[model samples]
Target chain A: MKSVEDINEKIREGSVCVVTAEEMKEIVKELGAEKAAEEVDVVTTGTFGAMCSTGVFLNFGHSDPPIRMQRVWLNDVEAYTGIAAVDAYLGATQQSEKAEDYGGAHVIEELLKGEEVELKAISKGTDCYPAKEVRTVITLEDLNFAEMVNPRNAYQRYNAATNSSDRLLRTYMGTLLPNFGNVTFAGCGEISPLNNDPEFRTIGIGTKILLCGGKGYIVGHGTQHCPGYATLMVKGSLKSMDPEFLRAAYMPGYGVTMFVGIGIPIPVLDSKMAEKLAVRDEEIKTKILDFGVQRRDRPVVREVTYAELKSGRIEINGEEVRVSPLSSVYMARKIMEELKRRIERGEFLLTFPVERLTPGKALKPMKTAIKLVKSVMSEAIVISPETSVEIAAKIMIEKGVNHLPVVENGKLVGIVTSWDVAKAVAMGKTGKVGEIMTKRVIVTYPEEAVELAAKKMEENDISALPVVDKSMRVLGIVTSEDLSKLLAR
Target chain B: MFLRLRFDSKAVRKPVISAVTLKTSALINIIKAEVGPRRGELIVEVDDSIAEKVEKAFEELGVEVLRLKEKVERNERCVHCGACISICPVEAIVLQDGRVEFLDKCVLCGNCVKVCPVKALKLPTT
Candidate 1:
């Protein structure tokens, strides 16, 4: 058996022959693991997917007066500045408080493009750091260190999601079309790194890898890592993380997601390792669940092989469903090819794991609690019907709210939204709230399910619904934002 | 005269050129043909004298004649992720200068539409 030292010597001499996980399978099948192990020096594994827990640590070299940033924002997107002076952690999923569309991922992308991003920070003046606030533009070059440390990434395999109910479900799986119109799954199937390795083997801590476009190393096993299933779960840290190697992605209807760069180097230590590297798409399997169910114990409708998923279609409960990958298989293949090119040019080398991951418990689902409408129904702001459209608009603008429920004499009358105001202004028919308000208002009861409220909003193409009591007294309001926040939680 | 034809399951696989040639041989000359998996558009130059006859012939063969337009529509689903920028061969789809701009250089090749992960970009068919 070739040892790690032998692999290193081969890499140094440029005598190592490498194949992708996909190609190694054929080679192993043709030549057998024993023969393939002797011939192949390294097997490269790759996966490209949205890792939400990813974030970057940036050290903006001490400012002129050097303020220890207490509050930091990049492009209006907040960054955690609690770490150190002028250092902040920007998470992928953190959305801008001012602009809902902008997120930390967008900030990362702007930095990657070499574009100047507006950096704003506020801090209480200290004797050592006199400045209280700083607003300026900075590029990646301005940072002393910009490193990405993802707590969890590169899931070995993931479950596919579909909707069994009649309403469309907005989920991390991309919008699950109603009535199983589509199935959304993530991962590169056969080309996935963990699917190839199946075990830690040479993929533990300290293993050199391709992170984004730069060289990185496996730091440790990712959080929520479960290893009993034949897949390797690991997180990698970049050496000199460059913007070119990373991508910031935004999912429509969903929030921001980070496209993590991951490449694993497998040393052919023995026949068993070689065999594991040769696993194919048909060999990898994952469970498919109906995300429509609100409870944590959502049933697994069926088990599907990656081969079936990659084919773009699958059958669940005797119904034909179209399948699309939320993660880009095309990008995954591109990463594998790029990694191969690096290895062939002798630009990348294999490194042994300094530490191995221990077995971890499986992740438990969050239990369904009280209905959201009831929970959030207590403190909703209400406006009077006699309140002028202009006044209603003012209240909405001042409160940064989209919907204003019109209540008269402690009873719900109608509702007015920012869109209604804009439309009324455009139509030159602005006056009292009663004149322009939607009288046939859609209302939800506090006792109903949050999913039902969301479905009503989606069905009526409205953003907010007033939660009312049996006597029609306005209790609270549930908006699309609230539903999205609940789902995110 | 250009025709934007949407083929049904029955007519998708049928030979269009052969059938049209046999029916209206010298009346129509196809200048550009863009065919996707389920639909096709043909920019054809019909002899002005027999244009009416050619239209009638295509209608008989169940080929739809549609009006052509030059605008590419970006639906509300566009999150402006800029995934389509790199794949545009003509640099028509660009997000470099802080905003997504669909330049006049677009050839309506639909490459951006295909690459868009959110299915946001739509090219005018007719």
Candidate 2:
């Protein structure tokens, strides 16, 4: 068994033989694990995915008067400034409160492109800090320090999701094409770090890793990490993993996710680690679930190996379903190749983890109680069905409400939403509210659970629901926006 | 006479095949062709006597004739993801030393444009 010290000595001498997890699999097959273990010094693992938990910590350097930033925004996307005076954490998924699509990821991309990003901050003037507000543009060169630290990333493997219902579902899995038309899976497949290690042998706390294009380390086991299953355990025991057996994926409509560049260097300690790296895609299995079900307990339709999923087809419930990976294999391979180059050139080195992760830790599902929604839902604004469509639209715009319950004679008769008004305007059908408002409205009771209400919204494909009582009196209104706000909190 | 023609998505599918068939009929020589998924550009040589006839033939085939001096264009949509940098066989696109530079070494191979996941690279169409 080779020791970490031995590997470091070889690296220092520039005589250490290294191969990607992909290449090592072939080498191990040709030469048994015992032979391969002695020959290969290091095995590199790579995965690229849109890791939303990622963010950059930036120290903008002190201003002339040194304003302690209370509120910070980069290109309108808010950055957490609760840290120190000028330091802030910009999360990848944090979007501009003003702009629709621009987010922290875009700001980073723009910075990498060598373009200036607008930095706006508001500070409460103090004795030491004088500036009330600062608006300026800064590029990567302007920052004193910029480092990306992600809490959870490089998941070992992921479950594939598909829609079983008749309607289309827009989720983080991308659009699950209606009726299981497509299965979307996001993972690095065989080359994945945890997939190669299986039991987290050589990777832990401080294991050096490739983050983006820079060198980083594994901080901890990622969030939602569920281990302990013999899921990817290979049979007949030849130990060596081929990164090629891993598949790269790309999720449509979800932006590029699981495409975040990640590489982990594995120190070949013995034949056991070599055997783990040799695991192939065919041997790695994942559960496929029906995300169409609104409940947290979504049913697992089938269990398929990564090989079958990567082949672009899997049988789900006896029907053929086309599968597509949301992560890019090309990018993953490129990351692996780049990491290998860095190591061979003596620019990168592997580090031991400061702490190892405990296996079999299950992530508990978050339960959203209905009481949270009731506290957030404001009083419902009622409108007369006789109100003109133009006036109803005006009320919705002025009041900043998307849904307006049309009540007559003290009973909720119909509902008019912003979408209905927009559609009316688009179709040139401006008239009375009664003519355009939806008479058959889907609703929920104040006593109903938030999950049930959210499920109803999903089933009907509506954004807003009028909360009513047993007497059919409008109590309040809950919207998709409110649920989002609840979740955001 | 020399000309450069840009083809749309439909024409890019069977670019050479369609161009060769049209070349036989129009009596124009296809000097070279570079094709990609969304678009492609071609260099053609035609006798000055039949230049107008060849141009008409390409136009009928729904190909846009670009100015001969026009080069590949990068649009505002470019996220500068650097996907094109490594794939460029000519080292035309580069991301080095904190800069993303497009060099003149570009052979217009169109490989960078195809590899761009963002669809930001645009060939000289106008």
Candidate number achieving the greatest TM-score relative to the actual structure: 1
In TM-score terms, candidate 1 sits at 0.67
Give lDDT: candidate 1, residue A111: 81
Candidate 1 residue lDDT tens string, B59-88 = 676777653335467975454434455445
For model 2, give the interface RMSD: 11.0
Q: In model 1, where do residues sit more than 4 Å from their true spots?
A: A228-245, A365-489, B1-126
Tens digit of lDDT per residue, candidate 2, span A20-108?
88899999899988888999989888776556666678889989777999999988988999999899988767767875445777676
Residue lDDT tens for model 1, A1-489: 988888777767888788887788899999999999999988877777777878888888888798999999998899998888988999889988886556998788778667899999999989998999999999887888878777777787888888887776666666676787777777777777767666677778777788876777667777778753433333333335555446666555577777776777788899998888878778888999988776566779899988898665688778767666656555566677788777777788677888866656686867656575887554567887677778887888888898888888888888888999999989987788888888888888887778778878888989889889889998888888878777688
State which docking tier applies to candidate 1: incorrect
Docking class of 2: incorrect
**TM-score per candidate:** 0.67, 0.63
Give lDDT per model, in order: 0.74, 0.72
What's model 2's lDDT at B56? Answer: 72
DockQ for all candidate structures vs. native? 0.06, 0.05
